[model samples]
Target: MVFSWRKRKPRNGDKKVHNMELEIPRHFICPIALDLMKDPVTLSSGITYDRESIEKWLEDGNFTCPVTNQVLRSFDQIPNHSLRKMIQDWCVENRSHGIERIPTPRIPVSSAEVSEILFSITDSRRRLDRCGCLDSVHKIKKWGLESERNRRCVVANGAAGVIAAAFDAFAGDSFEKNAHAHLLEEMLCVMYWMFPLAQEAQIYLGSQASLRCMVWFLKSKDISVKQNSITVLKELLCCDQQYGEHLAAIDGVNRILFKFIKNPISPSITKASLMVIFHTVSSSNEKTKAEFVEMGLVSLLLESIIESEKSYCERALGVIDKLLETKQGREFATDNALSMPVLVKKILRISELATEYSVSAIWKLSKYEERVLMEALQVGAFQKLLLLIQVGCSDETKEKATELLKLLNPYRPGLECIDSLDFKDIKRSF
Candidate 1:
C-alpha cells in the first residue's frame, strides 16, 4: 500500500516551518515502528522526533535523531524546550483560576494482606531483607499517595504487626534479643505509615497489647525505635480515651514514661512522653492519679519546665495545667513548693510562644491558685499579658489574659505600680 504525505500544521509560536524533504535510505528507517509522528517536537540537542515513541527507543541506547543525527544518550537528555515553555505559559494563564487536579483514591489493605505480601517477598525474619521488597516498602512508606483512608490503613496494619510481633516475642519466649531488635528497627522505619493504624487499633485492642509493645520497644537500646515507640504510644493515648484506664494499669508504665519525660535524649521522644503523661493524668481515675502522684510524675513534670528544651517546658506546663483541674491535682500542686513559681514563670515565658492551648493552660492554672495570679503580677507577667494583647493575641489568649488581668486587679496592691498604669498606658507600653 502506498502512503500519502501531508504538511504538518504550524504550532502557535512557530516562526517558520521548514519544508525540507527526508533523504535517508529506506533500509535505515526504524523498522520496529514506522507510524507517522503524532506530536512531533524538537529537543534541545537539535533532534526532531515524535515525543510519544522516543521514550521506548531511548532504552536501546545511542539513538540519534532521525533527521538531525544528533547523539542522545537518554530520554531525559533530550529537552522538550517548546513543551516546557507551553507548560509555563499554561500555568501562568491558569494561575488566577487555579488548577484543580483530581485526587486519587487510596486503597486500604489490611495488616494480614500486607504481611502476606511481605512474607511472599521473603521468609526471613526481617521484612526488608528481600532484594526488591525493601525498595517497595520504602516507596510505600515515603512515596505512596496520601489520603485519610490510605493513612488509616497504613497505620492500622503497621501497628497491628508491631503489636502482634512484640506480643508473640514476649509471650512465646521466642524473643531473639538481637534479631528481634533488628525487626523492630525495620518496623520503625515505616512508622509514619503505621501511626494512624496504632491509633485506630487502640480503640479496639484496648491498651494491653499496644502498651506491652510500647514498653518493649522503649526498653530497647535502639534510640530510633525507642523514639518511634514513644511517639506511637503517645498518639494512641491521645486519640483513644479507652486506652487511658488500661495504660495506667500496666506495671512500670508510668515509671518508664517518667524516665523518658525527665531525661529523653530525643526532643520528639520527650514531647511524646510528656503528652502520654498528660493523657494518663487526664483520663486516669482518682486511684490512677494517686498512683501517678505517688510515682512523682508531678515532680517530674515540674522539673521538665526548667528543661533546656522549649518543647519539654511547654509539655510540662501542659501536664501541670491538667493536674490543677482536679482536687488531688490542686493539692499536689500546692503541697509541692516549686510547682507554683515554676508554673507561673512558664506561663509568662510560654506566653511569648502564645498558642491558644498554652494560654488556656495558663488561664486554668491562674483560676486554681490565687497565689499564682498574685505571683504572676509580682513578676510583671501582667506586662507580658499586656504585650500579648497589643500584639494581636488569639481569642483564647486574649480571653485568658483578660480574665487573669481581672483576677490580678483584686491583688493589685501587691503588684508593683499596678494602680499607676491605665488601660491606655498598658496598650501604649506594649
Candidate 2:
C-alpha cells in the first residue's frame, strides 16, 4: 500500500492543531538548530518558514529532508548528509574568500566623531581642573584638542595653550575692550585650574606681560577675578627661585598684599596674601630676606603672628621661623626683646591650641646656638621648655628642652632654685 500525505485539523473546542493521541511526524518538525522566529513567514498549515534558515538550506544545495526524504521548501524540511557536506564545502570556500584581502569602504569623518573629540577634550579639562593634576595639563599640551573652526572664538581653546596665546596676543596691549572677554575668563580659569602651568609658562614667556595681567586682575572690580588673580600671583612666585626677584619688584604686589594683611575684606583674599608672604619669606635667598626685613616685613609678620585672625597665625609663625634663620633676623628679634621666655610662652600657647607647626617653628628658632638660646635662657625660657617637655607633646620640644638643659649648669645658684622645689613636699604643704 502507498502512504498518502494527510493534513491535520483541530477537533471541536480543541486549541491544539495536532491531536494528542496522534504523534506528529518528526520530518514535519522544524529543526531545533534554527532559533525562534523573529519575523516568521508562513508557508502552509503543516509547515512554517524562517527566511534565513531556508536561504541557508538552499545555499547548501540540499533540497530534501534527511528524515522523511521530503523536498525541503519550508522550515519543516531538513537537508540530507551529502547535500549538507556540499554546503559546508561552499561555506568554506566563501570564508576563505572573506579571509583574503578585500578593500573596505572608506567613510568620511562624521559629526559624531568631531563632537566626541570635543567632548573628550572638554571632559578631560574639567577632570584635570577638578583633580588639580599638573600632569594632565602637560598631556593636554602635547595632545592638542580639536577646535571648532568658525566657533573657535566662542569656545576657549587649549587648556595651557589658550593662556599662552592670550598672553602673547595681549602683550604690550593695554587692557582693551576688543580683547575677548571669554578668553580672558578662560585664562583665569586655567590659572585657577592648574596654577603651576601659568607660572612655569611665564618663565618662557617674559614675566612683565603675565605680571601686568595678574596685577590688572588683582585690581578688577570683580571679587572672583581678584581672588583668582591673587592665587595666580602666589603660585607664580611660589613656582621657583627665578621668579622671586621679579615678584619682589612687581609694582603694587607687596603693597597690595600688606594692605590685605592690614585690613582684608575677604577671608580668601586674606589667606592668599598670607600664603604669598609665607612662601616669599620661607623660600627667599639671603638677599631677598634682607630686602624683606628692610621693607618692615619682619615687623608686619610678627604683628600678624601675635594679633592677626586665628587663621593667619600659623603662616605668620612660619614666616617668623624663616625670618629668624638669619643673624640679622635674630638680632632684630633680640633687639625687639623677643626673649626665649616670650617665644616659649607663645609656643606653649600655640601647642595648647594644637598648632604643631607653630611649635615646630619655635623649636627651630630655639636651635640658633649663640644669641637666641642664650637670650631665651636668660629670660627663664627653660621653665616653659621644661613645661612642654613634661607634657611630652613633641619629640622636638623634648629634645630642645634636653639640649637647653645640658647647656646650663644646674648647680648654678639661679638654676638650683628650680631644682630645690620638691613637688611631693609642695603638694603635702598645699
Best by TM-score: 1
Every model's TM-score: 0.54, 0.48
Candidate 1 per-residue lDDT over residues 194-281, each given as its tens digit: 5455433454335454466567778878888888777776777767755766778877887888788656677788788888877887
Can you write out model 2's per-residue Cα lDDT over 188-303, one digit (the tens) per residue?
55446544554335563336766666666766778888887787667666666456556656666666677777777698888887777767666556765665556666666665
- Report the error of model 1 at residue 201, Å: 4.8
Candidate 2 — what's its lDDT? 0.51
Which stretches in model 1 have alpha-carbon errors above 4 Å?
Answer: 1-189, 198-207, 335-341, 347-370, 390-397, 417-430
Error of 2 at 83 (Å): 54
Candidate 2 worst ten-residue window by lDDT: 421-430
